[model samples]
Target: MSERVDLWNNGNLVQDIFLGEIKVPVKVLRNDSFQAWYLLQPRENGNKSSKTDDLGSLRLNICYTEDCVLPSEYYTSLRNLLLKSSDVQPISASAAYILSEVCRDKYDAVLPLVRLLLHHQKLVPFVAAVAELDLKDTQEANTIFRGNSLATRCVDEMMKIVGKHYLKVTLKPVIDEICESPKPCEIDPIKLKEGDNVEINMENLRYYVDKVFREIVRSSISCPTLMCDVFYSLRHLAAKRFPNDPHVQYSAVSSFVFLRFFAVAVVSPHTFHLRPHHPDAQTSRTLTLISKAIQTLGSWGSLNKTKLSSFKETFMCEFFKTFQEDTFTESVKKFLDDVSSTESKEPSGVSEPVHLKEGEMYKRAQGRTRIGKKNFKKRWFCLTSREFTYHKQQDKEPIFTIPIKNILAVEKLDESSFNKKNMFQVLHGEKPLYIQANNCVEASEWIEALCRVTRCNQKRLSFYHPSAFLNGNWLCCKATAESTEGCARCTADVPADTQIEIDGDRETERIYSLFTINRSKLQKLEEACGSIAVYQGPRKEPDDYSNFTIEDSVATFHTLQQIIDIVEKLNESHEKYQKKRSSSAKYGSEENPIVGKVS
Candidate 1:
């Protein structure tokens, strides 16, 4: 009798008949075929009632015919399947072999797959597969690694594998890109000459270096080999770029120091799992690099000797002591504490208010503003009770001062067609000073503070003509808003109005009278009123001054009289209390003669 066996035909089960116990081999007619061969044995009980015990299945060679190549999409599908399986199941050797073959034979076809694997954080498996092949040692691999964005994505992985070789290949290119980019320093390189001021582009360089080091830090968390490689690469490149020029070298080192790489490492030791024995060599190597960087700074001539000396005396000395003890966290913390303490001890701005007069109060605010159409320059402005002075740097003399009393108005400006924001105009007589804040909120705060101290309310000044004093055009002259046209109606030509002058003087006197009260007397009167309020006890309600007429002189006079009465009552009570205390002391001494003996 013949029995039928099942076989997969186009992924569907189909039956094949065998005439005898001897098996017949089947031939695949298609160019590509999938074959699964298996052996079946009788059950242990030896019952041959059509059921058999299956041992295991074997995946036979699934080969494509000559002139037929596997579709590129098939490789992609296989790669994705392998990556998906890597999450839950270990990828079989057969699957890894297929991927390695694809990568080696059709490298371009598998590049996208490799990138996808890297992006999905399946780098370990991908690298394992690549390791099985000759890809790493190939010229094509290096070209692909260097030419594409994959370098950045897999920099850490590559570093773990290639170490300094990867850094050596990539560092120069990054530095070159940074050097060629638009820098914060506005130096024209073509016109630059010897002895001319050559700004180091510190900001742009810092940004570039920060990005590189951040990637290095992220990679170092998993691969400790990156720590030494990255630092060595940076130090080597810096030396190569600046050779014997300590000034440029100092700038490069300063930029790196500003990144606070060591501080970040110390603060996030857990992230890197940076233990002495865990990553034995890397731990010592990282500390050595940090120490070397700091020591290099001490030897730089570009840094201010006085400031550097102070830093050495404080941060460097403490850092080295703790660093030697392997207390990295404490070392960083102490260094930061010393830095903060030193900064806090200094004046808030570039310079102290060196010329502040007695009884005058001042506040320092730091901001940048355009001066006479040039680029915006940072300035430290000191606003006093009566004047505003600005300095270029700390310890420098004031470059300009404007009397706050002379300020006619301060108006917030709207963003124009350009994307400019947080701008305001300060008007003094007929001249306008345009200033800008970092943001709208900062501008609003400055406006509020200036109005309060200068006593020039924006609301009251809003009624004045918008262009009254713009570009030196005066309202008194009835000149055109454009100063170029000149004043057509000069006040000097007209006869003096005696009545107007008298009215102005009387108004000024009235305003001055509001501030003429002695502040010390007012303080005493306030204390007296507070005492009276306490002595009266909690009443049903207190008098509401909300409805009081602001312009009523009679009402003001009555309020002043009430305050005087309260002060007089408080003085009388104080005098009586003093007399009572003296009498009590005398009576106590007479009553207790033994107390005086003890004393």
Candidate 2:
């Protein structure tokens, strides 16, 4: 006889099938309330053969309905299992799918989980999984994943693990999205009145411009495409508004400096030197943007030459004055030359390279050189008239020194197999010492300066080689040698006029003196107008204010004003009390003549 087997869920019989078909797949009811599973068998009977002998059985490991509510403990256990087995391929995929679902609607809840994944360097897989899921909350999940701090950390970690190229492809879109969000550029209207309104506005503009450029720089380190977008945005803004407003002019000009600084920093972090080797494509792109920006500024300046000339001069002078002591002075000078009008000539007099006697320092700059075959390191180079010495950082004694007299020739090397473009080889009796500069211009400057100090002809330096200026078939004159009847570019054969001796050192000193005088007057004005706060404390004040001190100057002024108001109020109250006391004494005397007589 045929017998039936039944499966019960929470005391409700959900499924019935023939007992003989126990090996076949059984379909059970799908419901949240279904908790337990049971199997029934035919009761033992005295027949020829019974289809099933067992009377009852229990089934474990049954899957509940998809809508069934899971306990917190069950979820925790599942998550733990998933995390523990994350290294396994199938388990990892499953975990990612489940975690994505869990975090789909509740991002805040799963932040801890996300942090845990980031901590363990497992975020990429999870992010990849979430990216693949076609869920309604995918965009939200992506946003949560690319939240600023988290996204930065994730990108940093991915860069370390998967490298910059990989992260560039994977995370660049996210960075672009983050950078596309606009920041508030409002300035404090109150501060605008306390100082020169133009200066105040310029400062605010500079701060915002710096903020935007810094973000662009950070983003461009990996994905260079964003730089074009940032450049285009700035150029657009500057072009549209620069002609109408000085504030826009100031922003455009300041942004040009900012871009130049960033470009130099990217190519040469040690001294911000813009050498030929600094990723040509990127550097060229940045420099092109800067040139365009500067051209825009120059055009505006030219249009409003009479009105804006003072501002331009002051801006350039102040910028140079601020960074005069830094190695970037030369770079800034080059930028000024590029952007400034022809009428505004930089101090053109060539300064005699300072010659040192004994311990006197002629010049000092940061340089890098190879000590051995492959051990290249950066060092502090100090030049004296007698010798050029290099030292390790913070060392009292020099690691190496080359006598000025021993130097035969200083020649710039071409881009070679081992040496870079900004390298100069000093021939000191056949023991060639190769030194590198931050950029081609710096290298040329060093060579020229060294030539002058060593009593060598500066024009004879390798950089001044005629071939250096050749552009393929054309000379520096822009005429093709084949097309021209004769080499008219050969000016060396022509007798030149006598060289005019202009004291560049004296002119530079004069410029600096003027700058110092103007700076002092400005400082005095700032102090007088309460733009700069003066502390009359017991201790002596510092000549240069600390960053914190400068930031607190305005607040300190406001606080002093508050204190003065409070003191005046207290003084008025004290005067009133004194008047009341005197009146009371008079009244007491009038009331009692005996009391007055005792007094």
Task: Tell me each candidate's RMSD, in Å, in order.
Answer: 38.1, 39.1
Instruction: Put down candidate 1 lDDT per residue, 1-599, tens digits, no spaces.
Output: 32224232222232222111212244442326656564643223232434343433334555643221122332343344445533321222222222322232333223433344433445444443332222223343112212222222233333333233323232334333433343442123443346544335323333543444443322221112222223333333444444564343233222322233333333223223332111112232233334343333323232333434455334333333322322322332222222222111111221333233211112212222222333345666666545766667655777777775566555554444113477655655544555667767666655554543343212223223322332334433555454343322211110121001222222222212221223343333334444444455665665432222122333333344443344344345445655665666655563222333444
TM-score of every candidate = 0.18, 0.19
How does model 2 score by TM-score? 0.19
Q: In candidate 1, which residue pairs clash? A: 350-394, 351-394
Lowest-sum lDDT 10-residue window in model 1: 490-499
**Per-residue alpha-carbon lDDT of model 2 for 1-599, expressed as tens digits?**
33233342322322222232122134443323434444544423322324444535555454542321222332332334334424433331242232322232333323434444533435545443332221222233112222222222322332232232323333334323322432222233332234346455445444433333333322221222112222233333343433445344223333333333333243232222222122222223233333332332323223232434454445433322322232232333333332222111122122332333222111212232222334456766666545767667534588778776566556554444233457765655533466667776666656654543443211222222222222333232444442333222222110112112233233222222222324443243235326344444454555433321223445433333332343344345545655665667755463223332443
Q: Which run of 10 residues does model 2 get worst, by summed lDDT?
A: 490-499
Model 1 misses residue 241 by how many Å? 84
Name the runs in model 1 displaced over 4 angstroms: 1-375, 417-419, 456-599
Off by over 4 Å in 2: 1-80, 84-93, 99-105, 134-203, 215-599
